[model samples]
Target: MYRFLVPLACALSIAASATAAPRLVEPRLHIDKEHIGPARIALTFDACMGRVDMRILDVLLRERIPATIFVTARWLQHNRQAAATLLAHPDLFEIENHGAMHVPAVDYPTSIYGITAAGSPQAVAREVEGGAAAIVAAGAPQPRWFRGATARYTASSITEISRLGYKVAGYSINGDDGSLLGARAAEQRVAAARDGDVVIAHINQPSHAAGAGVAKGILALKKSGVHFVRLADTVAPHPTPVL
Candidate 1:
């Protein structure tokens, strides 16, 4: 009995040590390097709630610009018509998970504008799965990307996201339309985007001038020979882990 107890204690210690070690995350979510390409940029938007500024979306669709939209469950429910519209235009937009309730985590400390990170692994999965269900119900193909609330994601969350068979998305550039600095500044920000850059913006709260500016910038860039690509197409495929 004593021998067995001693071995059990040692095993527990080893297991705890292994768990304490830092987890591995995808390079794209944290790394800041670009590969060879034709200067492609993925324009993304986060639609949280209500009737969004369709004007911005209209521009993307009419211009045939490809984009990825990280949407929440609440947003889809509140704006089903708009959600359906986006779903119909598959060439212009790809729907991705942005969390369920967008609840911030208390156990871990992370922030974007002083907001906490999303909840635990299980909680995060629920958020992601829930949004995926909503998308499917609303007639959109399931999302392959997961962007955490506030865009503040941790290493653990990244591991969970990968385990759930979704890519962790982090932008290389921010157009800052959500920051609301007028359309001109927003256009300038988007114009500054380079090759292999993933530009982030918001279309949920469209009362600001910057969102409009972001749309304008994309068109202007197109006129100057900049081509837009869907984030799914731009991202490196996640390699399946060997068991």
Candidate 2:
């Protein structure tokens, strides 16, 4: 019995050590230029919490540009009017899950960008599923994608999210550093986006200048004839992970 226990403990230690550490990755979508034809960009916004940034929405509405929005259950519950407005324009917006409580999808006791993580596989499931359920309850079609808060995840969490039958939405360009950037900085970053780029910005901070800049950058992209597409419409071949 003692010999068996020793081997079992050693195996457990080995397995634990093999688990990969959490990585901060910027996930990039592989756009097929031949199939897509011309420059195609996907603009994704995180409605994590707080009021909707009308500055950004208004531009999308006025210009008829389509965008994918990842919303948290908390955000949906708090911004009913904004949710309704988004739902009204099914042609321009596709809503996806951003987790239930706006927690990072890390299967350990850790934090990402100052936000607490899900901390366990079970908790991660709860966060993802809860957000999906909220979208359905709000009268939108079931979400096919999930973008965890902070856009950061543990390898195990990413696997778990995929196992749950949702594609993890990752961004190639960060238009706003969590809505912390000023207007000019955000505009510059967003306007510089290239073809096949997946741009991520925030739509939950109405007062933040980043939202205004995002609007301007999107207009600039439109002026340059850069076509916009939604994640649901294009095939995002395996995301390239950035360390």
Per-prediction TM-score: 0.77, 0.89
Model 2 error, position 121 (Å): 0.4
The stretch of ten residues in a row with the least summed lDDT in candidate 1 is: 24-33
Write one digit per residue (lDDT tens) for candidate 1, span 140-222: 78788877665655566667777888886777667873546788898888888877667788887678888778878888778
Whose TM-score is greatest here? 2
* lDDT per model vs. reference: 0.71, 0.89
Cα deviation at 194, candidate 1, in Å, is 1.2
> Pairing residues by index, what is the TM-score of model 2?
0.89
Off by over 4 Å in 1: 1-38, 104-116, 235-243
